[model samples]
Target: MGIGDKRKSDAERQERRRQRLAVDGIKPMTVHFPDQDRSIVRDLSRRVLDGQSIRQVMRELGGSNQPDGNVVPPEVLAELDYVKARLVAIEREAASQLAEIEEAERQRRTLEAERDVARVAEAEERAKVHTTATEAQAATRAAQEAKERTTEALQRAEKAETAIRRARSLPGVRGRLVRWLAGDVLPD
Candidate 1:
C-alpha cells in the first residue's frame, strides 16, 4: 500500500478501537491543545486517543512538559522559583519560632512548679514555727505558775518563823518548848 493508504487504514483501525472501547463502557482519554490550527489540533487529539500521555503529546508538539512552563516566560519562572524558596524559608522560620515558644512555655511551667513547691515548703516551715511558739508559750506559763507557788510558800514559812520567835519570848514558854518549836536539838 501507498503511505497515504496506510495512514488511512491506521486511522480506520483506531476509530474502530475507540468505538469498541466506548461500547464496552470504557472512557476515551483526552488532551488539551493550545494551537489554533485545525490540522494540528486534530493530530494532537488523534495522538491522545491513540493512548499517548499528555507529557508525550506536549513534547511532540514542541511544548514544555513542565507545568506552567509553557504559559509563563523564563523571567516569570525565575521569579516563581524565588518566591517558592522564600515561602519555604518563611515556613521553616515559623516552625522554629513555634518550637522556641513551646520550649519557653515548658520552662515557665517548670519554674511555676518549683515555685509552688517552695511556697509549700515555706508554709510548712511557718506552721512548724507557729506550733513551736505555742508550745513555748505553754511551757513559760507553767514555769511562771510554779514560781508564784514557790514565792507564796516561802512567804508563809517566813511568817511562821516570826510567830515562833514571838511565842518563845513569852514568860510561860520554856526553853525546851522553844527548842522543839524551832526544830533544834535539845540538851538532856
Candidate 2:
C-alpha cells in the first residue's frame, strides 16, 4: 500500500479499538520497564499478543486488585458526595451538625492561643538578650575608663620623680623634702 493508504488504515484500526474498549468497559494503560528487563517484558508482550488475559496474569502474579472493570468518572463521584451530604442533613438533627461546628471552632481557638503564647515567649527572650547586651556595653565602658585613669596616675608619678631627681642637689631642706616625698627615687 501507499503511505497515505497505510496511514488511513492505522487510523481506522485505532478508532475501532477505542469503540471496542468502550464497549468492553476496560481502560488502557502503558507501562515502561528498564532496558535490562527487556527480555522479560518481551515475553509478557508475546503472551498478550497470543491472546493471554492480562488481568488473569496479574492475578496469578499475586496482585490483589480484583476490579469489576468499571471506572466511575470524577464528576459522578463529586455528585454522589453532594447527594450524600444532603441526605444526611435531611435525616440528622441540626444540633448534631452544630456540635461539630463548635468542635471545629474550639480547635481553631486552641491553635490561636498556642500561637499567642509562642509570640509572648519569643518577645520575653528577645528582651532578655537586649538587656544582657546593654549590661555588657556598660561593663566595656567602665573598663575603658579605669584604664585611662591608671595611665593618668602613672604620668603624674613620673613627673614627681623627675622633680625629686632635679632637687637632689639642693643644699638642705628642699633636697630633704624632695627626697622624702619621692621616697625611693633618691637614696639617702
Candidate 3:
C-alpha cells in the first residue's frame, strides 16, 4: 500500500527465506566427499562447479544424522536469549510494582475500616451522652414537681392547724364544734 509497507513486506519475505533455508539444513559452507574422500567446501550454492578433494563446493543436504545443521545460527540464538532476559527483567519489575500497589491498597482498606470503627464509636458515645442528659433532665423535672407538691402539702397542714387553734380558743364547745367546722368531726 505504501513505501514503508513495501519495505516491511520485503523484510518479511527475506526472513521467511532465511527460516526456510535453516529448516532445509542449508549452510553457507559445507564439507564434501571427493573421490571417496571427504573435503571441506566453502560454498554450497554452486551446483555446476566440481573440484576434487581441494575443498570443493557441495551441498550437504542434511539428514537426521546432522541435526545441528537445521538449527538457527549461534548469533540468532544469542540475540533471542538477550531478548528473553530483558523480558524476564521487565516481568520481575512489573511484579514488584504490582506488589507495592496491592500493599498500598491493603493499607488504605485498613485505614478505612479503622475510620469506620471510630465513627461508630463516636456515634455510640454521642447517643449515650444524649440519653444520659435526657435522664438527668427528667430526674430534675421530677424533683422540682415533688418539691412543689411538698410545699403545697405543708401549706395545707399549716392552714388546718390554724383552724384547729381558732376553734379551740372559742368557748365551751371545744370538742365536737371545732371538729365539725374543720370537717374532722362528721355531723350525724
How well does each candidate superpose onto the true structure, as a TM-score?
Answer: 0.53, 0.44, 0.51
lDDT of each: 0.82, 0.79, 0.73
Best by TM-score: 1
Ranked by lDDT from best down, the candidates are 1, 2, 3
Count of residue pairs whose backbone atoms collide, per candidate? 0, 0, 0
Winner on lDDT between 1 and 3 is 1
TM-score of 1: 0.53
Q: Write the per-residue lDDT of candidate 2 for residues 63-151, one digit (tens) a residue.
A: 54674356677898899999999888866867787889999999999999999999999999999999999999999999999999989
For candidate 2, give the lDDT: 0.79
As for lDDT, the candidate ahead, 2 or 3, is 2
Best by lDDT: 1
Better of 1 and 3 by TM-score: 1
Model 3's alpha-carbon lDDT is 0.73
